[model samples]
Every structure is written in C-alpha cells, then in structure tokens.
Target: MSVRRPAAEVLQPKSFSFNEKNLLVVDTILSKYPKEKKASALLPLLDLAQRQNANWISTAAMKVISEILSLPLIKVLEVATFYTMFNLKPVGKNLLQVCTTTPCWLRGSDDIVSACKKKLGIDFGETTQDNKFTLLEVECLGACSNAPMVQINDYFYEDLNEDSMIKIIEDIQKGSKPKPGPQSKRTGSEPHNNRVKV
Candidate 1:
C-alpha cells in the first residue's frame, strides 16, 4: 500500500523527548539488554512510540527513536514495519480489530465483520467519519480457543456472538470497559482436551 506522508510543512527534523513515564518504560526495556547491545531496545522503543500516539507510529518518530538508541534508520524501519502492532497511519480513537484467522472464522467472525460494517458503515482499514472508530481484520492474536474475538483499542473481546458483539461496541461507545475473554464463561488458558495429544 502507498503510504501517505505527513503534510510538507509538518515534516520537520525528528526529535524525541522521552518523558518520565515513557522513559521509565524505555529504561526498563533497555536494561534487559547488555550495555553494548543497546540496539536490542528497538521493539520496546517502538512500543513506547505506539503508546504515545494511541497505537500509530510515524516515520519521523521512528527516525527520532533510532537516533536515540544509536541504531541505523534501516534497522529501526525493519523493526517498525515487521511488527503488526505498529500502525504507520493514523488510527481511529478506537481501533476495532477482529481476528479473522481460521479459528475465528470458524466461530463466525464474518458475522461480526458484517455487523461492524452495518454499524460503522466502513470496511476494514477505513475510519469512521467522526474519526471515532476504525475496523481492521487482523491475523491470529493467540486467543483461538476463544474463537471469534476482537480487539478494541488495546483490549481483547473474545468468544463473541452477534448480541455480545453489539453489546461490546455499545459499551465502548458509552465509555465503559467491556468484559474480556469468552462469553461462554471460560477463562483464558484452559487446556484444549479436544486436540490430539502429542
């Protein structure tokens, strides 16, 4: 996909001001690496950037982060682009990402997607006119046992049927936190006995 650049006037020199909170996060991540291996902090740094921008990572921001850790631009770019967590473009205030992998699909995520389209009137990768929501179809988020699942903002909503899905969206719209995990009363981390044992 063609990346749309920021307006010419806004494209200025990359300067990163690491605030106390994010600096603490970066420092903690940086501590995990040996002194000489500061470059290993790239993913964590990218995460910090994402958190600051509500899940989006700007190229200029990446460049600035690269400079902070003394890593090459290409190195930072590779890390930024490689991870699905990083968003290159502006995301809506609430990003509604449904897992569309096999397990989720089998659990009726297509119906969830259709519901989202009906409610938001926008398909995946498109933002609502109010800029409040964006719908995206994502790959496995490792909640397959929960089957049909979606992530809003940074929280995951799993084991969804149509009614449950609608309720979750409405809750988010009303500024309430929806309960996470399966609607069927299963907590996360239940061992799947149905799978053939090794």
Candidate 2:
C-alpha cells in the first residue's frame, strides 16, 4: 500500500463538475469538518464518486474532485492513483477483490483465485468478456480470520474451497448476493489454525 499524506494538508477544489447529488455529498463530507479544513473530506468525496460509477473512479471525476476541493490535480491524483481501491480502468459489474496476503495464500486463496480464473476465463486484473465479473488480487483485507477470502463488489466470502468458491461465483453471476461469512460450518480455527488440535 502507498503511504497517504493526511487529508488535512492536501489541496482541494473549490467547485465540483459532477452532479448535484455528488456535490451535495461532497458538501456534507466537507461540512463534517471545520470550515477551514475542507480538504479532510477527500477520501469520502472520492468514494462517493466511485460508488456512483459502479466500481472505478474516472480521471474526469478526479478532475471534478480537484476542482470541487480546490486541490491541485497532482494531489488528487496522488490519492486516487495510489489506492488500489480506486480503479483508473473500467471494471466488471461485479469486482472480485481476492485477498492474497500471506495468511490467505497459506490457507487456500490460490485455489479460490484459480477457480475464478477458470470460471471467468480472465486472469487477475482482467474482467470477463460478458462484463459480469473482474478478478483482482489484493493484499490483506484485514479478514485474516477468514484467511482464504474474497470480496465481491462490497461483500466478503471466507474459508472457501474450489466447489464453494465456484458456487459463490455462480450465485453472483445469477445476480444473487451470497450472504457474507464462513463457507464451512466448522468454527474458525479448525480450518486455518496451524497448531495441532490435540
């Protein structure tokens, strides 16, 4: 992850060029802070833009954010480009952000990743031709308890195997949002715990 300069010091735009709602949202975010510290709301403002655009933030949107917050273009770019959550390119309707950090990798994230590649027919960072899904491998999502986990759109699936993983993908493809939690019934550690259970 890239180091973030505190939102306090960054420059912001004075006026936004997006939409009334977004401008309203930006206004709300700005209002939460003292009048002199509007720059502190950059993250939420950009997040609102990303959510409105489905999954990614566009360069134009960044420009609008810059203008709205009265920040320099490069400063806004610094925040937008540095975060993996901010997508410069188009992503699928459903984005699968797989956790490939060490714990996830050691457990079975690779298996889940492979299943996604086979089912979607697109490698990581690539979206399916049908525009239904995109696969992305990301670092620790702070879901280590559910080590082998994947975040689809805004939901998380943990303790996954090949079959369960496929089932979850199929569910998403069918427009069903699978409930977030462990795939297996076994209470946590039995699956990921490295210590002997004796």
Best by TM-score: 1
lDDT of each: 0.79, 0.78
- Give the per-residue lDDT digits (tens) of candidate 1, residues 5-89: 3334234435556677887888788889997898988887888887887667778788878887898889898888788878777
lDDT of 2 at 53: 75
**Candidate 1 clashes between residue pairs 3 or more apart in a chain or in different chains:** none
What TM-score goes with each of the models?
A: 0.84, 0.83
Q: In candidate 2, how many Å is residue 142 off?
A: 1.0
lDDT of 2 by residue, 1-198 (tens): 112223344344343355777767777788899866777778888888888876666677788787777899789989987887886666788888888899999998889889988887878766677778877889998888877999987777888888999999888888888878788775554544455766
Clash count in backbone of candidate 2: 11
